[model samples]
Target: MKTIKPILFFLLFFFTISCVNQKQKDQEEIKQTVKNYFNAVKANDLEKCKLLIEDSENYLGVIQGEFNFLHKNYDEINPNDVLLRNILVKDTLITFTNEKEKYVQYIIKNDKNPNNLKKPLIITFMFYKPVGYDKIFNRVILENHIGWDK
Candidate 1:
């Protein structure tokens, strides 16, 4: 009975560690994919950006509120380099909500790079809806323009 208990405990511990590692890998992948997407945007590489973003139509919601100026027909985002940092991937979704609420569903790159040491990198093209549009005024609203600290 003592031996069995030890074996069971070890198995549980092993499984827990494996799950945690997997989650960490997934997060790192998502981060890298987001980084790549932004790099492409900075270079004005529309084709590369399109490859990263999901093909689903209406990824970004309608621009009826103060964000109407941002509306344009294009797969890749054309935000200024300063605003590029506003995009991030938390978990499975690559969220771009700060500047102008947006989200995308993505897929992970299967090929692994041992040198990179960042595995399970997740990528997604997401969509988002503004929480409160009625509160905004007629003037241009530039709320939350901060970027991610390096």
Candidate 2:
């Protein structure tokens, strides 16, 4: 019985560490996605940005709207570079879908407009894991220009 208990404890510990490592890997991937997005916006490459996020029809208008103004008068990048340091990320523990999952939100500052004022944009990512599947798929949300508090 003593040996069995030790074996069970070791198995539990191994599983816990595996789960933690998986979560960390997932968070890093999400952060990279956010970074890629900012880089795309700075380069004014809409196609690359589209590829970086979820490819969905519902996002077409939102993505275009954000960039449409770029040619008009506003810009998406700051006067200086907006690296990962310039952005703040928060991960929510609440699930929007299933599997006790969560979402990630990134708060960032926009570039100087033609009028030379900077603004804020909210970029969020939601991921869902399929039932009985080990993989997760991500969907991105970007909100801007509505008087963001931060």
Candidate 3:
């Protein structure tokens, strides 16, 4: 009985370490995905962004189109002026954390677009990782709003 306890304790400790390492790896991959995704968007490369995603639509371009329209119509706006500054990520901590990691929220921020777009269009993405998957299997844009100065 005493030996069993020690064995179980070691197993649990190793499992915890493994889980942490996995989380770290996931974070790195997710960060890279974000950088690639937005860089593609900024450059208007819809195909590249689509390929980076596992199972998702090319909706980022739709948002880009809107920005383009504003840039063309408004002298104060320039889509190229939008620059991504940081990307924030947080896990949803759902019931199936182990099986899916359910949802991860990513808030992408851009440096102030002097183009009268006050918020500079904050983009939020919800990413999901499936069980036994090396990459995120699902993703959706939660929000993309460029509050106008007008």
Give lDDT tens digits, candidate 2, residues 59-148.
Answer: 777666665543232233343444455543344454554345545565566433444364566656565443211221343364675543
- TM-scores of the candidates are 0.43, 0.62, 0.55
The list of candidate 1 runs beyond 4 A from truth reads 56-150
Quote the lDDT for 136 in model 3.
Answer: 38
* Candidate order, lDDT descending: 2, 3, 1
Model 3 weakest 10-residue run by lDDT: 69-78
When superposed on Cα atoms, how far off is each prediction in RMSD? 15.2, 5.6, 6.3
Number of clashes in model 3?
0
* lDDT-superior candidate, 1 or 2: 2
Ranked by lDDT, the better of candidates 1 and 3 is 3
For lDDT, the strongest prediction is 2
lDDT of 1 by residue, 1-150 (tens): 999999999999999999999656644554455566556545556455444544312332321221232223112223354334544534233356434433333323223343443333232333222332111111222222121000
lDDT of 3 at 28: 69
Candidate 2 runs further than 4 Å off: 68-83, 86-89, 93-101, 106-121, 130-140, 144-150
The deviation in Å at residue 45 for candidate 2 is: 1.5
The pairs that clash in candidate 2 are: 77-111
Runs of candidate 3 with Cα error greater than 4 angstroms are 54-85, 93-120, 131-150
